[model samples]
Structures are given as C-alpha cells and as structure tokens.
Target: MLEIGGVSVEDHLWGGRIMVDLPLACWVILLLEYLDTFRLEVELIWPAKWGLVKLLYVLDRFLPFVILPFVGFYNITANPSSDFCRILFAIPCMGIIACIFIAEAILYLRVFALSGRSRTILVVILINGIVVVATCCALLARYIALATWDIPRPPGVSGCKGTFTDGKLVMIGYGTTLYSGILVAVLCVYFGIRLYWSRRPGRIITIFYRDGTMYFIALSVMSITNVVIAANLPTGFRFLMAPFQGVLTSSLSIRMVLRLRQGAREDMGLTTVKVPDIEFTPETSGIAMDVPRTRLGA
Candidate 1:
C-alpha cells in the first residue's frame, strides 16, 4: 500500500474512477436521447427542406457522438503522455464549443422570430454570441496553456487528468455560458410579454416563450451549481458538473427545436380549421385561429 502525502494511492485512483463515471453517465444519456428522439427527427426534420434550423438541429443532435468519444477517452484511457492529454483535452473542448454554438443558434433564431424578425434584435444576438465565444475561448486557452501535469495515476486507475494552475478557471469558462442564456431569456421575456399583452399569443408564440423560459432556467440552475461547486469545492471535483451540465444543455436545446417544429406543423397543417359562420363539423373544436403571421421555423 503506497501513500502520497497522507492519502493512500488507492484513494487517488478513486478520483480517476469518478472522472470516468461522470462522462460514462453522460454517454448513457446521449445514447438514450438519440434513440428516443430519432423517430421524431425522421417525422419532423428528415423530410423538411434544407435550412438553417435543420442544419443546426442535425449538428447539435449528432455532434455529441463526435465529442463524447474524446471525452471518454480522456477519462478512461490509462495514464497518457502529457502532450497527448493536452491534445485530447483541446479536441473535446473545441467540440463542446461548436456543439454549444449550434444549440444557442437555435434558441437565438426562436428569439429573433418572436421579435418579429427585428434587425435590431439580430444585431443583439450576434453581439451576445461574439462576446460569449471570445470570453470562453480566451479562458479556455489560458487554462490549457498554464495547466501542468506531471503526476501519473496508479497502474490500476485510468485517466489523463491535468492539474490546472487554478482549476476554478476551467469552471469559470463554463460559467460564462450563463451570460448567453440570460440575455436570450431577457429578450424572450421582453418580446414575449409584449406579444402576450397585445393579442392572444399564438401557439408558435407560446412555444417560443415556453421553451425559452424552461431552457434558460435549466441552464441557469446548472451553470450556477457548477460555478458554486467549482468555486468552493476542492479542485479535483471542479469539473464534477461539466458532463451533467453539457448533456442537459444539449437535451434541452434539441427539445426546444423539436417542439417548435411540431407546433409549426400543427398550426400550418390545419388539423382542425375553425370557421365562425360555417360551423358544425366533426367532434373537434377546431384549431385556434391566432397562429403567428410568419412561419415558426426556418
């Protein structure tokens, strides 16, 4: 039994197992969600015309497979060279950024549509995205550059853990994501409230606010939890929430898109049309007549 500092080497290996477990859990979620939602994608997305929304959906839906493998490798592979760890770490982080960008783009598009396709709102979304991407990139770059890793995991344990100059810095990069979600939430509420007061909000409008509110709240809670834990907890556990939060963000973002597309199809397909004077039909009350003027999807 070997001991490093007062802790047994086995205890240190346990930490490596935890890192593997976190990402492994995320792998389960990713697969389950894909199988669960594939039918919906076929019904809603596959037949639809090629457009920005579909592209974003396709990327967000499939990107995880590409990213998660690297993440898994980083955690489960036996002690790897420091150079290899840096490369593996960079790949997953870049993949995460790309996937997140795609998801956020979907949300931004919904917000843009709700704003009646306002150019001003478009500019705001662009600026917000630029800020978020730049901030996260800078922080990520700084941490990777300053990170150091010389210690090797015990023979039985597996991981490519890098000791950060300040582990909290990595979590800080994640916390920056909250800024994007908050701005989107604010835009949603601002435009959403106006629409609510001005008229009987249509199905599309309701979906925009509904999905927006839920998505923002979920991400906000997850981000804050990550930041809090990272700030207060030991550096080893700093990334305890990353996989959980990442899976959640992807899941919520994709659901929002699917719901909107479904709403658009429902409103447009005229499943039940209501005519005031010429009433009396089947057992249906007829679909409401206040659907948004613009198409709800890209």
Candidate 2:
C-alpha cells in the first residue's frame, strides 16, 4: 500500500480519491434542496392543522432532511466504536424506513383518489403496498443487522458507510428495486389512461399528469441506478445508494404535495395554497365520487 505524505492509501475504502468526496457533495446538495423548499413546505402543510395523513406526510417529507445530516456528520466526526454512535445510527435507519412508509401511503391515497375512490381498487392497492413495504422493511433489517463501519477516511472525506454482510442481502435490495420500478410503472399507466380519457385535460388533471409522470420517471431512474450500483459495486460503495434515494424520495413527495395543494388553492380562489385533503373518501364510503372534484382539479 502506498503512503502519501505519511497517510496510508488504504485508509479509505475507495483509495481516498474522488469516491470519498462524492457522498459529502451528495449530502450538501440534498440538504440544500431541502432547505430551499422548506418555506413552501411549512406554508402548504402547516403542522397546526395536521391530520393523521398530513402528519405522515410531514414525517416522510421532512424526516430525511432532519435525520440524514446527523448521520452524515456522525460518520465524519464520531468514532464508530463508540456505543453512542452505534445507538444513534438507529435514528437514520428507522427514519429512512418511516419516510418510505409515509411516501407510499401518500401514493396509495393519490391513486385511490384518481380511481374515483373505488373500494375494490383501494383494497387491492393497499394489499400490494403492504406487501411491498413489508418486504422492504425485511430487507432493510437484514442490511442493518449486517452493516459495518467503513475504514475511516482522511480529513475532508465522509465515512458513514454500511452494507450487507452477505451477498444474499443484496438480492433483497434488488427486490426493493423491482418493487419500486413496478410501482412507478403502474402509476404511469394509471395516469396515462386518465390523460387519454380526459380528451381535454383541465388544470388539475394536467398538473397530476405532469407531476406524476415526471416523478415516476425520476423514481424509475433511481431504482435502475440502485440496481446497477448494488450489483456491480463493492459493499462499502453500496452505501452511496441510499443517500440519493432518500433525497429523491423526500423531494418528490414534498414537491408533489405542494403542487397538488397549489392546484387546489387556485381552484378555491385562495392566494396561497394550504394543505387540502388529497386523501378523500366518498360519502357512502364505497360509492364512486365524481372524478374531477375528487381529484385535485378544477
């Protein structure tokens, strides 16, 4: 192993090169994105009036922004051997799983509204979502159990890394990737059919079309990237995947919520959009409501 100015080259898992810099950059960029949009998040989904669904939305959208930075900083500054750091690691792990839960819940509500609140559709989607999320949690548990601290990097590099102890654990990640990709594809098809039938799409349907399509594409790309990285990269390098995923998940979830609320505001003659009920059920609970009003459209 080469020594550079007395620093051992093997001190970093990725040769102490650009790979060491990437996660820091990723954290900075993701944190900045969260900070930039937070004002709008607060305005639209104010906690003062948060219901159960809105509460979940807050946890999904903001929790990553809050927890990830701690994880990043800890990885850089704290001794991994310390009991406290190990204990603290649980926060991000749990936070990440919680965020996924909230995001999927929001997505399910969105589809149910789009499907005119049909009981059959909601039941099917709920069952599928539960299965998918439970599988993800099981995989995540394996990952956490097997996770290891990366070799400490030199100054100016972050080292918060974790990976599966067994290659089989990676197949679980592949399962998650498949689950996410399929979910996004189905949403795309749902919106595509809705857009087709509308013929003359209104502002609301147009918003849903634009937002859901772009978000789906973004998620699909992320899922593909996760698969590639997990399949090809070393276990230490695989830690890179979750930061990007967390950032994208938070941004998409919060932004889509903002857009839906924005359209609802315009429809209601409000100057600034506040959180409207995106998760609406029909009066009869099983009856199909009018799609337009049930949707976030005018």
Candidate 3:
C-alpha cells in the first residue's frame, strides 16, 4: 500500500470524501434550518429595512449554497486537470473567504451595538479588526497560491488531489480568526456585565449574552481544533472542520439577528433589535418593525 505522509493513500481518499460530504451535509441541515426559520426571517428581517446588516445576513445565509456545487465538483470530478482543480478549489475557497468576512462584519455590528454607540469603542474595534482580518486575508492568499494538485493521482484515487506545502500559513490565518473571535466575545461579555450591573438586563440583553457566549465557545473550540489540525495533521484532515465552522458561525450569527428582533418589545415605540443608542439593524421578512430609533435611553 502506498503511503503519503505516513498514512495510507486509502485514508487520504477517505479524507477527500469527508471534505466533500461534510459540507454537503452541513448545507442540507442548514437548508432545512433556513426553511424552518424562514417564517421568522420573513417576519423579523425581510421588511425591517435595507442596510449593511441585512446585506451581511443575506451573504452569510446564501453564499455557502453557491459554493456547495463547486465543492462537490472538486471532490468528485475524477482525474481533472491541474488548472481545472485550481480553478474549482479557488472558487469555493473564495466563497468561504467572503462568508468568513461577512460573519466578521456581523459580529462587529453585534459588539458595537452592545457598547451603547460609543465612538471610542467603535474606533478601537475598527483598528483591531482591520489588523486581524487583513492578516488573515494576506495569509489565505499565500496559502492558496502555494497549493498544488498532484496530477495523475494513484489509480482508484479521486478528488482534487490538492495539497499545500505550507499548511502553517493556513494555521496562522485561523489563528488570527481565533484571536479576533475571542476579542469580540470578550467585548460582548463586557457590555453584558455593564448592563447587568446598571439594572435588570432587558429581554434582548439577556438573549444577546447567552447567544454570544455560546458562539464564542463554539468558535474558539473549532478554531483551536482547526489550527491544530492544520499544523499537525495530513492534508486529508486539515480542513475537515471548515464546514462545521462555517455552519455554526453563519447560522448562529444570523439567528442572533433574528431572535433579537423576534423578542423585541414593540410596545415601547421602538423598532428593530438594538442595544442602547446603537442602531444596528438586523432584517428578515416581517414582525412589525417601525422606523429604527435610538432605544435604551438613546
């Protein structure tokens, strides 16, 4: 049996299958989720308003579906050309990049709203987030640039047959992601603490904190696991967790938007799910939103 990276080539084929199947599985589950909550989205987000947040939501929600076909194509297209594999790989990776960037923007809006519209907080976040995301983008380009497809793969082998020499670049990109996610999570916690100390946390505040905590915990664990895998594991398993990361981040981030709107106290002459004076708009379909206004003593 031929060995690649001390693992049998047979196992490597399985990894390729997993890479294709995992994302397909996630998409099926998420599509079901999207359908299940579509009523909520229509009611809570669709009619709220058009804004950056709505745009982010749409991209985060639907972009993965666009990339799913490419994933399947890359994995199942037997004996594809190096150029074809390169193109297919880049398509899905680029879509993932867009998904991740949109997810970050969504998180940024969440943290900003939690800070009560503090200009100081917003600017600080701008600096940190720019640095982290920029680093990630640069490293991702390097990783993809260095990646190669082993043409004429062994008989009975399938998939893109792609591998990169410097998995460290990818590990570093995810490391930056981990750092940025923790910072956002910590900020959410800080604002939550402030709200609790000041008075009874509003219905939305309690919800935000609960969801934010869970998001961060899941993000951290997945990120660390991804980094570890990228560092120490064979290419077969390096990105096995990427699908899960995308599903969790995009799904929960959108849910945070929807749930906040669904639970809003519309009787207070308020519209939109907001924190303090910060008016970050999250959109779906309906749910009776009024003109977005400053809430929580804005």
Candidate 4:
C-alpha cells in the first residue's frame, strides 16, 4: 500500500484505474462514431471542412489507442529505474503536450478557414501558440528532471519515483499549472464570444469552434488537475496523474467524433447542425454564403 500525503496508494490506484477505464471504453465508442462520420463526410459534407474534421478525428482516435495505452501500461508494468519504461513514458507525455499544441494550432487554422484570412487572426494564433508551447515545454522539462533524478520512492508506489528536493521541478510544475489555467481561461473567453456572436446573428460557422471550445475546456481542466496533483500530492500518488491525462485525451476524441456526426447530420438535414458550404462560382465569386440558423437552443 503506497502512501502519499496520508492517502493510500491502493485507494488512489483503484480510483485511477476506474477513471482510466472510462477513456478506454470511450475511445472504442468514439472510434466507431468516427468511422460513421467519415463515411458521412465523404458522402455528404463539403470537402474542405470535412477533410479537416476527418484529420482531427483520426488524431483523436489514434492517440487513445496507440499512445495513451502504451504510457499507462508502461507505468503499471515497468519497475522503477527501468530505462526503457522511463523513456517510453516520457515520449508519450511529450507527445501529449505536442498533440495539444497541434490541436490549438489547428483550431486557429479552422477559425481562419471559416472567417477567411485575416492578419489579426494570424497574430492572435501565433501569440497563443507561443505561450502554450512554452508552458508545455517548461512542464515537460520538470517532469523529465524529476523522473531522471530518481527521487526517493514513497512507500507503496509501484513505478518510477519523483524528486523530493528538486525545487526546480516544483516550480516548473506550478508554472505549468498556472500557465495552463490562464491559457484555458483565455481560450474559453475567446471561443465563448465566438459562440455567442455566431448564435446572436445565426451565422453558419463550422461546428469546429463550438466543439473546440468544449475540447479546450476539458483539456484545461485536466491540465489544472495535473498541476494540482503534481504540486500538492506526494510522489507515490503521482500514478493518479494518469487518469486526468487519459480523461482529457478521451474527451477530446469524443468531441471530434461528435463534430463529425453533427456535420454529417447537418448535411443530411436530419438535425440542425448546419454549417454553410459556400461555393465560389464565377458569377458569385465574392458573394458570402447564406448563414444557417444557430442551434444554441438545442
């Protein structure tokens, strides 16, 4: 029985295991949903938006199956100080951070795709990306250092240990927590406004913005949870961190699947998930597409 800050490792691990299973189940369900969406997109939804949505959906499906399980399995199976396990675990954590960055970058591009090219939008995206990347890098560095220094294994923990005296790691963890919190808040506000405005005028914007907001919010919450876990919990309790990451990734994947399904439904007119597919014909090259009604009420 590992003990961290008076919490039993068995209890924590049990909870983590339960939570981790949620994502595994969710991933399978969402993968099927993604395939359905892919077929619909190819059959109905317009090419450009459908293609982008499909790509993101694929990433979502790939991560839970290909990336997350590896990390979780390694964490559970490998003994502490196993060089292979440590490297494997670190690679995926870094991959998670990288995936988040890619998601954010794609969000900006999706917005641009919807709103048309604008210098201001480009600037905003660049700035946000820089800040988020830097924050992730700091967190990664701290995680690596802690894992590498081989902090004293707290009683009952089953895997790699963390540094006890490393102020740097603590600081990095805290910084990551604070930075992620701030970033999420900003994104929420930004997307919230877009969602609101899109609704007020009943614009036919891609469902990407609405769904992206939800995804980011989930990610932000997970990041905050991780930061809190890292900062307050003992090293043995670190295993609990896996669930938060897993949940976040799973939530993102779900959102992608939902977006695809919604897009398909809208294309089929089965529901109100309408996203305008504006065509630029020679006769109406500059004419804007008719905005569809927002489904805010639904």
Q: Could you tell me how far off, in angstroms, the CA of residue 1 lies in candidate 3 after the best superposition?
A: 4.8
How do the predictions measure up, each by TM-score? 0.84, 0.74, 0.84, 0.60
What TM-score does structure 3 among the candidates reach? 0.84
Greater-lDDT candidate between 2 and 4: 2
| Residue 48 lDDT (model 1) | 62
lDDT of each residue in 165-278, candidate 1, tens digit only: 765667777678887888888887887666556567666567666777887888889888888877886655776776667677788888877766666566565332221111
Give the higher-lDDT candidate: 1 or 4: 1
Predicted structure with the largest lDDT when compared to the true one: 3
Give the range of the ten consecutive residues with the poorest summed lDDT in model 3: 280-289
Q: Model 3 over residues 26-61: C-alpha lDDT tens digits?
A: 889789889988988876677656778888889999
lDDT of 4 by residue, 1-298 (tens): 5554345667656754654565466456646755755654444343336555556644654555565565555545435564665675576666666555555544555454443455775687677667767776776666665564343445555544333343345446435544643554465456445544545322223354456657666666666666576567655344345434544555554454455445534543544435544431112211244545644432
lDDT score of residue 162 within candidate 4: 37
Candidate 1 vs candidate 4: the TM-score winner is 1
Model 2 reaches what TM-score against the true structure?
A: 0.74
Query: How well is each residue in 29-111 modelled by candidate 2, as lDDT tens digits?
Result: 76787788778777667733657657777677667767666555545553455345544566666566566556656666666
Alpha-carbon RMSD of each model: 7.0, 5.8, 5.4, 7.3
